[model samples]
Target: MKKQLTAIFISLLFFQLSISAVEPMKPQEFKADIIIYGGTSAAITAAVQATRMKKTVIIVSPDRHLGGLSASGLGFTDTGNKGVIGGLAREFYHRVYLHYQDKQSWPWQQQTEYGNKGQGTPAIDGTDRTMWIFEPHVAEQIMEDFVKENTLKIYRDELLNRESGVLMKNGNILAITTLSGKKFIGKVFIDTTYEGDLMAAAKVSYHVGREANTTYGENWNGVQTLVFQHQHHFATKIDPYKIPGDKKSGLLAGISNETPSPNGTADDKLQAYCFRMCLTNVPENRVAFPKPDRYNLLDYELLVRVFNSGWKALFNKYDPLPNRKTDTNNHGPFSTDYIGMNYDYPEASYQRRKEIIAAHENYQKGLMYFMATDPRIPKDLQQQLNTWGLAKDEFKDNGNWPHQIYVREARRMIGAFVMSENEVLGKKEVPKPIGMGSYSLDSHHTQRYVTPEGYVQNEGDIGVKAPKPYGISYNAIVPKITECKNLLVPICISSSHIAYGSVRMEPVFMILGESAATAASLAIDNRTAVQEVNYNQLKTLLLKQKQTLNWNGKP
Candidate 1:
């Protein structure tokens, strides 16, 4: 009986092993020549460029949507000097122009009736056949078209397993695993993420918040407690206490009590973030602002005070888009920006980041609901706001809210080279020119604090204009050889806070993305590390691809 029992046990064990052998393995690992992360415009452009170079590439995207802010209701393109835009960045705008040529593209309005106005420039450049301003859905469709045309494989909603996902050997990443156990193996990696998650995961050097002005010898790199270049600051002194001047009443919802450091000092604070809301006046295509479930009347009490102080620029940033829509951004003090609420967002865990994003959404939506329905607001302002509602046709997936939040700034890699205000202002010679940026060195409010005079005020609203277009260094996107050999960061390039202010535009991100991929493909062909890629050959390829490397034209 013992022998028979033993024989039966051995047979059952073999049967189980055979069953396991036939069972399907955990989903096959995705392998490609290049693995591009992030779902921003830069990721799409990089994937397209890699494919054009005849390399197998895949986009491992955390976002389901394609375009970042471009498709997230920033219809008013911030093209400071449109002449400097080239390569796939210019191609994107050309496609936008092509899209508008079709009368069917204008669903809510006629093509002839659509105004060609943009931010201080014509939205449609007839001479170049490029359209700068575009609706959110239009931008998304164009990005999708690029993917479909290139036949690029994109794994959507795949979150990187930041803790232990990166497999490396001798400073080279072998593969990256996502939270769902999906593995992506690649020869080269491009981190186009706004938060630089992959770059941080690879143990690369990076800096969060701002550097001291002395760190990079930049005048605008650090704390600007009194610098109010923009109109985002309060027009008049207002009490910061909940009970208006009662010291024991405590500070209001958004005001901070910490005495700000001296001007030009470094701090671990970030520029404010807000959703570039797409609102429309069309009754049929408008959804009234829905008050959040946890709405608090006191949250916007400061805004009410602003209104009572004769502030009238509430709608200054209600920039127009096609189809009678508006790309509503943060306007005057206490508008859409959730100031000082996102200080930890750059390094926050995924769960924590989501909560932060949710908080921002709630704050912004609540602000709008308050403006449109609250009796404390001026009647004329409320009436004007009531006429506009969320665009019904835009962002249908998330209650017509933009899928992306404007991450004005984030983790910046301290890579092989650092671009600074010197390069942006054409004060220093940039090396290994890859692309150009002409946007102003702009930063939104970073803190809302009580002034020494015992009044509420906003700080760190900077907008120093770039004198002319300047080259972005190839080394700025490359990591040090010892840190990591295979990763490239385009969106969060190596730059001081002041320089990144100029580099952190959507068009410029796309430009850097294309250039990074071109260099990546060359590196793969030569079997060399990204840092060792030949600059002459890279420059040849970039120019052939029509990237504007140097600018001799007027700004």
Candidate 2:
């Protein structure tokens, strides 16, 4: 039997070789004018736009899934105005509208039961251009439609070539490789990831942490202890000390390695990351949380303590989208924001990243289990947790857990120009307006701490309202002309920490994605590098393509 199996393996290898020989290497093996390196909403739209302009484009997706946050559990888009979102971004919503047309599409809801009358939502044919509401599966189906319609080539689960792979000649990218050793070559590259990995690997300058207010002379750029919008946590100042006003209780778990400076000097600390889970009453798609390897009970002791402390808003953060489903998020202090644990995640290798992901899953799942099953948990909170389960219809592969965590912030590229708080507040004028972000200058929980007075405290969670719709410059998307002549438009936006808070929404990503593709196509057409592409020509093309270059600018 062993000899027979070995012979079969040998035959399979020979068959694969035969197939490879038939497909001989062309001079530009799988060459595209634009090669995007993500499966994000922004990446897909960018590639689709390039394709629309008759440019051959391919997406080398590191993730197994497509449509990063948009297809993930972020269904309730944080878009300020539907008018501000246009181009392929609006088309994506239109596709979502199309998905709900068929009765079979409603696996969770009957078509007749699901009403079509929408306010300000664009239907497939622009009949009901109202609020865009969809389930995870619906979004995925629509994203699949976009790809099929455009005939875009996508290589899924392909890890990128970080070290010696990106072959560059005179500031132009020739080709990039995957860890499995697949090559994807293209002309203009779009770095549409939340983490900006490809851009960093290509030796682009980027930043990981917050900058001081002094660095940019901006008001919002600092380690502010001020609780502005949601002042629920800081009703009273709590102390970090263990002995209640004593000097030495040490610190709680997950505090930063760096000293806490008030000036917000560039520390590696970032806002929290959590899996935006989709939950339902269905059981078949829900997988129980196994007792994870390296599962530590001490990691969840704090959560148990929080439950005992009378915090029972487990579902408080759930944002409803469509089909009677929810896009659930982290609610309160120490809920789902794996605080201070993902510091090394942005730059870690795949193996290390997986380990961290497991740890996070274990932490979050163990917290839920501890709350639901542990006798120490408050009776009411435990009862509430027992009422919830993973949604059957979503993430059929990963037990309905979101594939991409809501990585609120990561390595923001320090490009030709940094979009600081000044740009968002109209203090500094954006030279070339590619897109506008109108979402509140919002930030998720940043740190969990033991106060000096012996109580738990969560700091740096901000929800500042934007004064008005703000303009984002194209300069933030490109590296310094000296660093690389090519454009690396981050769908997650490129800015200082505070500025990124507003620019990090899914709709903003779509907007930025469309603009990036327009610029890429224009650069290719003009026979110039992205850095040298005339802004005036790019602007003309963007307006012609139905992008919102001119904002409504209303508060």
Candidate 3:
């Protein structure tokens, strides 16, 4: 009996060993020619392009949904010089047009009832066969369609282990391990995230906040204490203190106490971030604005003052989408932008970033709830605001709130070429052009500070238009050869704060992604660094792919 039992135990041990061997030891590994680390529009475009180029590609995304802000309620496209948006970027818009052409795409409103309102053009441009504006779900569906059509492999919700996950050999990234312990190995990697997480982990040199004007010879790179270009600032003087004229009462919650430096000097402050909320007035599909748990009435004390000062432009930025839904953005100074609250977001740890995002969401939600129900707000304005609420059909899985925040600017790589206001304003030439941008050089207010005179005022809102559509350099997307040879950053390209204002649009990101993938493919085929890719050959392929390198007189 003892011998039989011993033999049975040995058999059981061998069976367990066989099972373990079959299970494999290392974390689930994915091998591909190109590894894109983002779920932004840029990631989708890059994956699609690489797959079309017949290269094995994988998107190891940190987001559960794709298309980043484009599918995150920023349906009103910021298409600057729509003609400059070619390649897969243009195809995405065309697909949006195709989706809307079908009657079933519009459920909340009829096609004829929804006027063709867009950014200075018709939303549906029949001549160009593209639709610039769309709903959030439609944009996300298009991204999913791209994934299906291209048969691209995507591992969603896999965040990069920022501390020590990047396995490097001779400055080339061999593999990256996610926090989930999944390892993705690739020949080339694309950092398409808005925050430049992979780029930062790879030890690429980057700059956050504003650079001094002298850094890039840029007119709009640094502090702008009193410069107001758009109607986003205080229309009239408002008090900064909780108790007017009382020094000891302390400044209101949103007002900063420190004095700003001169206009052209540098500071670590970044432009404010807000949710590009999808709101609608359709009774059947409207979900009333829910008050956040930590709602503080005092947080919006300045907004109460704005209302008392007769500020009535709350709906100025309620940009309409395809349906009755609106892409509500920050309009007046105290509307949606939680200024002076996100200075540490660019390099924050994952938990800290979550706290920041939660803080912003809570602030914005309280702002809306206050507007809708507070007696401090004007009755007319309150009634008007009560009509609008979260769109039920959008972001259904996430409490009808956008899953992504508008990370306007973050860690910009100081790469092989740094785009400045000079290049954007046409004062300097751009070499090895990959794409073009014509959006106004714009930045939202960075701070709401109490003036020396003890009055509340905003600072760092800029909107200088680009003279023309300017070329974006390919060198801007590649890191220095000494840093990391295999990685390409399309979203956070090397640019000054002001230059990034124009290049930070979603369509432009998609354009850069396609161009970056093309370069990555060329580099793999040539067995060279991204910086050493033959530009002449890259330009040829980019043009062949129908990317608008130089703005011609065509869309």
In model 2, what lDDT does residue 317 have?
63
The lDDT for every candidate, in the order shown, is 0.92, 0.72, 0.92
For model 2, how does the per-residue alpha-carbon lDDT over 1-555 read when each residue is reduced to its tens digit?
Answer: 999999999999999999889986443356778989988888888887888788998998989888887788877667655667777777777667666665666565565554543323322234534347667777777778778988989989977867776877787777888777777777788988777878888788777877787877766665655454554353444444434466565544554434355745556677778777676543454444445446666666656556556666666766655555667777766677787777788888878988877778777776666666778777876676666666766788976677887778888887777888877776677889887777667676666665444466666677777666777888888887777766577654568888898888787787788788888888888888787778998888778877876667532
| lDDT, candidate 2, at 248 | 61
Task: Score every model by TM-score.
Answer: 0.96, 0.87, 0.96
Model 2 residue-pair collision total: 15
* Candidates, ranked, lDDT: 3, 1, 2
Model 1: pairs clashing at backbone N, Cα or C within 3 Å: none
For model 2 the local lDDT of residue 436 reads: 79
Question: Which one wins by lDDT: 1 or 2?
Answer: 1
| Candidate 3 lDDT tens digits, 1-555 | 999999999999999999998986778888999999999999999999999888999999999999999999899999878988899999999999999999998888999999999985679999889999998999999999999988989999999999999999999999999999999999999999999999999999999989999987778889987899986888688988889999799999988889999889999999999999999999999999999979999998888888888888888889999779998889888878899999999999999999999999999999999889888889988898899999998999999999999999989999999999999999999999998898999899999888777788999899999878999999999999999999999999999998999899999999999999999999999999999999999999998999988866764
